[model samples]
Target chain A: SYYEKVGFRGVEEKKSLEILLKENPLDLEKLSTFSQRFPLPSMYRIHVWKVLLGILPPHSDSHALVGGYRKEQYNDILEALHVMRYVNCSTPFTDVCLRMFQLESQVLPRCSETTGPDEENEDFLSIARSMEEIVDDPIDCYWLIKCFVHQFHAKFGDSIPHLPKSLEHYLSQEEPRLLRHLKNTDALAQLPYGLWFRRCFAGCLPESSLCRVWDKVISGSCKVLVFVALEILLSYNNVLLGISRPEGVAKLLCNIPQENTDAIVTKAIDSWHKYCGTPMHAV
Target chain B: FLEDVKCQAKAELQSSDGRYQAQRRITQLLQTELLQLYSRVETEAPAGTASGSPPGGRADSYP
Candidate 1:
């Protein structure tokens, strides 16, 4: 009901989404093309992402399970954020959140001008606080979806290119010059996208831009995570090529490149299409 | 400026001693994560090769 009212509502989009959702084996190709171009209607993101990530089992009852999983886990992250801000840090979740903050502020791509030294907002806490019943803020959904993505990454890390290899492979094909420049940065010297990937590109991407990319990711393949990330990083090719140090490279990539999220998503789609065209490239 | 001060003031005023223990804890937390990431990925792909393999090893084809 909420999703019908708040998400997946537009007539054409609703029809398309309905037809696509009914696929038995899931038409990932069709799903991929559709989602890469459009954001899932706001209320519809979590479940679609679950299906795309294979977080939800391929069964008829997945729709019912989505609500239970989202509510329970969203509260857990909120509690974890509260513990970090108020109580003494004891568990692994606080550690994870802290790492998330560091990755965003330091190693992820961010804008230099707007990223002043302002850590005042219990930004995570406020994010948790602001979440509505069905969740408007997908940041929490990131933690949840990312849990699924991490499982996919880890389970497949040994098989598919792990995050670092994904980055190395993608860069080799797309941004050779920038790859050469970052050869020495401590972070990248060993694995440029390792920490970035472990953190699920949280700090590295803006919420809006990341959500758009996640839309494609949830529908098609988790491998899209690395490709879109590569897409984003390669979009910064000129900037990255100029910076030889890993720290500088990390900072450049960590900052959200610009405010126009749609532009970034559009560019990433082009990169995704091109990368996917060379079937064996980085997937 | 005010945001920084408020953030700072909140942490600083957390106790009479004026030390925000959370900063130290957070820094330590981040350090742990970096170490874990390095050990997990680097020992495997030191050369930064395009396959997720340990040194001198070949990647296994997916089943």
Candidate 2:
């Protein structure tokens, strides 16, 4: 009950967002403050994310081009998953961001091609180049895709040998009591991050909070995911550490209270900013 | 988009073209909890590794 964090109300948030949007290139510095608020307005969330992710075109594509890219997105995922399946496995959960992030990175030109943003912007240029390097290497491209899929199954697969590797990534820094609970077999099944990246919170958080997380991620980099996950755990740290069994710990993480969306997100944004001062440059 | 997925799922159910048979078959096989797909191909391959190795070889072997 004490965990909630205050966020901006309607008029204040709308005014902030409108100012950020008015600039021809989209005012990114203003965006940082706007995003930190958490639980952003619901209706404009998708449009806001498209801007941050560089999916929307500055000049609208012909309806056909928009339609074509959506089709291409689907085909690319099925194609990539086709590659994964041949390897004889499948991700435990569907990755909603995979095609949009992966396929877009591989096939679509970065903001330079997609949004036609300022060619001189260092962030856009860096994002574009990193994407190109991954796409250009066919071997590395598939390897990345395979890891995305295996991240879910490989960590949570029923086999004893395939214990949760992702848990070790961050849990090593957690309180020992929490770390012990996380290592339990059942708790690992409902791992907070799982394998899907943004999809991990798919049906979990408030729509507004969820979109804000995406905004931070697309505008910055993949480094935001781990920081955000850690923030969530910190909120329930003492309560979670007290729990004895795996199922109990999992139940707490799986059903995080909606009211704390504001707090969880605020902390996550701050930590993401602090830990990832320079974006890691990978998707 | 959901509608498109529903239609495709229906088509796959109604004996649609096997154009994506490999994709479909692999999804089906995964339900059996086979740890690795290509390994089965190797074991069952009448022609041995040369013929049995998957189109991409072992999925885990990817760099």
Where is model 2 more than 4 Å wrong at Cα? A1-20, A25-44, A53-55, A60-171, A174-176, A184-192, A195-198, A278-283, B1-63
Candidate 2 chain A lowest-lDDT run of ten: A91-100
Q: Per-residue alpha-carbon lDDT of model 1 for A1-283, expressed as tens digits?
A: 9767645456677678777778654555655566665567666676566555544434434434444454444444344345434223563443344334444234322222244443322333223222222344444444543444455445555544455676678888876766766665454554335434444444555666666665654454556667766776666777666766666766666665567556766676667667665233111
After superposition, which runs of candidate 1 have C-alpha atoms over 4 Å from their true positions? A1-14, A21-39, A50-134, A137-150, A153-155, A159-161, A184-192, A258-261, A278-283, B1-63
Model 1 chain A worst lDDT window (10 residues) = A125-134
Error of 1 at A255 (Å): 2.4
Per-model TM against the reference? 0.48, 0.42
Tens digits of per-residue lDDT, candidate 1, B1-63, equal: 576446434432332121223344444444444455556576666575764535223222211
Which residue pairs in candidate 2 collide? A88-B37
Q: Give the true-structure RMSD of model 2.
A: 16.9
Distance from true location, Cα of B61 in model 2, Å: 45
Top-lDDT structure, candidate number: 1
